[model samples]
Target chain A: MLKNLAAKAIVPVGLTVTGFVIVCSILLYSYVKQDLVADSIQREVLLGDIIVKATRFSMLTDQRESLRQTINDIGEQKGVEHVRIFNKKGVIMFSSNDEEVNQLVDMSAPGCIECHSGPVTAVHLGPMDQARNFVNAQGEPVLAITTPIYNEPNCSNGGCHFHAPDEKILGTLDIGMSQAPLLKSLATLRVRLVIFCLMVLVLTVGGVIALLQRNVLLPVRQLVYFADQVSRGNLEINEPEGTEELVSLAGNFKRLARRNLEADDSLRDLQDKLDTLTRQIREREIGHKSGN
Target chain B: MGFLRNVRRPPDTPNRAETAAAPGRERIRRLHRLAYRGLWGMAAFLALSLVAFNHGWLLPPISDGARAVLGKAPPTNLISIALVVYSFSALVLILSRMSTGQGKYKGWSHLAYLGAFYVFYHYGNALDANFWAVFAAGLTIMALEHYQMWTFCTEAIRKEEERLAQAERLEKFKS
Candidate 1:
């Protein structure tokens, strides 16, 4: 059964298409996942930058209540997990979560690891040291982006602020965004892609099989039956009709059968003539003998 | 026993040319059978080579320079075109036979086989499964036609030889 042409054709085609689908799925999933994560990180970073800008005046004026109110309001927006401002010493100066305010953040935490673990001093934090992923206490995946607030000349020169000429990094603003909605949408997209690939595969295989049956297998079967009949000395077989190849073959077979039949008829005619001639000669010889 | 009787009663004269040409005719018939067999052998070889080339088992050693000269299309396209040309030639041969009613061979049938081979070899990669199915069907038909032609030729030759022998004997008896 495996040696059959249909099996041979279908198996290889099916395998190749399946391999293509799997490879496409892997590549597409990775690409979409990467794109979604990158986009999410960019949005969160922009939000953190805006929050840092908004709270800069409050922080410099020593209005702790205003800074706390801004953080809480921003965190109430959809998809924002939390918004916090951590001082240079990794102390949570203000937080949307009231309990987290006035607490000391770990140096190894997602918001602090970028500047603390590296050889570079925390005072010279760059944009690359601002993003990390971690699971929140609620067990949801979160992307945190940190924006560093730099000490400006005005803050140091102004009469209300203390005299510090070289305070480059004042603090970091960390924004944590929930990734649940994005992941759910990605899962839905993946399911749709799988369904599309499967549909394509089924349609392609079905069309191939249908064409094969029509143009190849069915005609071939008819020709075989005709050939069998001819083999049994039944010269009265009808020619098969289908593709050009099969039609030509059946036509040739019919002609060959006719030729064989004609050859047999001619041979029979010759044998009959020879037998009659032999009998006439024998009878003539017998009459001649009797007369003598 | 038949040979003894004919020798004892040698009644008629024989055509000297017919007697002399008998062996030559027999040789010609043998050569014709050999030619058919050789044609089939060549066809089989071509079929196998086509299959091997299509499946990548047989790769022609073409250097990068040669490939550059040949362009990007697969070399099998050239082979398919050649086969198509050969099939056309076969078509002409078959037409000639039909007009003359001389040769018993089915050149058109061979043309069909070659055409199918061209299709399978040229477009098989794109068509995939349909290629194998069509190839199998075409090959089977070609094989059957070959057998039928072989049987027909053999039978016709045998019958002709028998008729000639009987006619010669009758002529001898009458004369």
Candidate 2:
């Protein structure tokens, strides 16, 4: 894209046009990436904070429902795709986007395996990657973290994802935030990086081209002009003394001039000798004719 | 696939003889004037009528229905709209210049007017008033055709042509 003649022209001015575009692209990509990441992290942390707090409640009371509403409010933040709830047993309790999956999610397997069927951590799954641990229950760069909650009864009893008969322990509170926003942030970052790279590449290319055109091509063109002069018998034209390269060029021109001078001298001597012979021949012819 | 097969290939070189026989650029311009000016006038009229009928002929026609559907009507500063209009006019000027093949001086009084208007609207209360950015960074690219109208001054192009012609003529004469 930068290889156009317009880009070539700019080389003499400063950076090539192509170089300027590349630099702009790189800067744009970096800026997009930074903004996207920042937005995603903000949303994720907000969601996680709200979810972790909500989990502490045991009953399926209005308060528990309110927790979903609170998360829904937070979910509206830019870049947030969805908010979800999971029990310790890995059952999906409430989801902001999908209402059908009221089934039990198996949280038995450690890490992300228990609930997520896809390539474990690759997707945003598990109580952890969805943010099972971190400050405000939100994780860092890897995934959002949030505290898993079981009802007080379940907590007061032994350790389990749910409650027993008369063992009225509330379900484990798991908040699954949409990683889409985070991924989007990352994608934006990727684009920004690409733009940044393009900008740098362009600037570098422009700078290099500019230098080459000014310092190399212009001088070489001048040298060519002088060489043409030498070829046309005007060997008196002076060569540049800018560098060793120029010095060598001047030497070559000098040699060609000397050779031409030598050839001219030889031709002149031959012409003179021919004229003298002609005169002698004419004189002999005249003297012989008179005797006859 | 069918379209691809049916697509005709462009000739390697234009048929100069046929073009030479055709009417001049002025005739072409007259034809364009008849065709597009009428079409644009009609289209703009209809669009305005439809909008006015639905939401009254005035500024900020944020329909209640729209508000109901979107939760809130997407709010935009009216001054921004005026600025956009000015930028659009400048873009049109630029296009005119380009069509005449003499584009230059893209930033004209109209663009400044738009920015000033934008500031006038946004000035009193609070907020940043920067409409030049809209014209330069946004509208210029969108309305590339018009940018030339404002930028492509006739004198500039004529001078360039004169210089080029003189140099070529001088070179040939020397040769």
| Weakest lDDT window of 10 consecutive positions for candidate 2 chain A | A11-20
Best by TM-score: 1
Query: What are the chain B TM-scores of all models?
Result: 0.46, 0.33
Q: What clash pairs does model 1 have?
A: B12-B172
Q: Report lDDT per candidate.
A: 0.67, 0.48
lDDT (tens digit, per residue) of candidate 2 on B21-82: 24434444443443343334334434433443333233354455855774632223454444
Kindly provide the TM-score of model 1 when superposed on the true structure, using C-alpha atoms: 0.58
Interface RMSD of each: 15.8, 10.0
- What would the TM-scores of all predictions be? 0.58, 0.39
Off by over 4 Å in 1: A122-129, A232-238, A274-292, B1-175
lDDT of 1 by residue, B24-110 (tens): 578658746743863674487456546644654444444669658855644443443444355335434533543453436553456
**Which segments of model 2 are wrong by more than 4 Å?**
A1-50, A53-147, A150-154, A157-170, A176-191, A241-243, A288-292, B1-175
lDDT at residue A232 of model 1 (Cα atoms): 74
Candidate 2 lDDT over A90-157, as tens digits, reads: 56666665563477654444334433445542322333244432222243223343334434443455
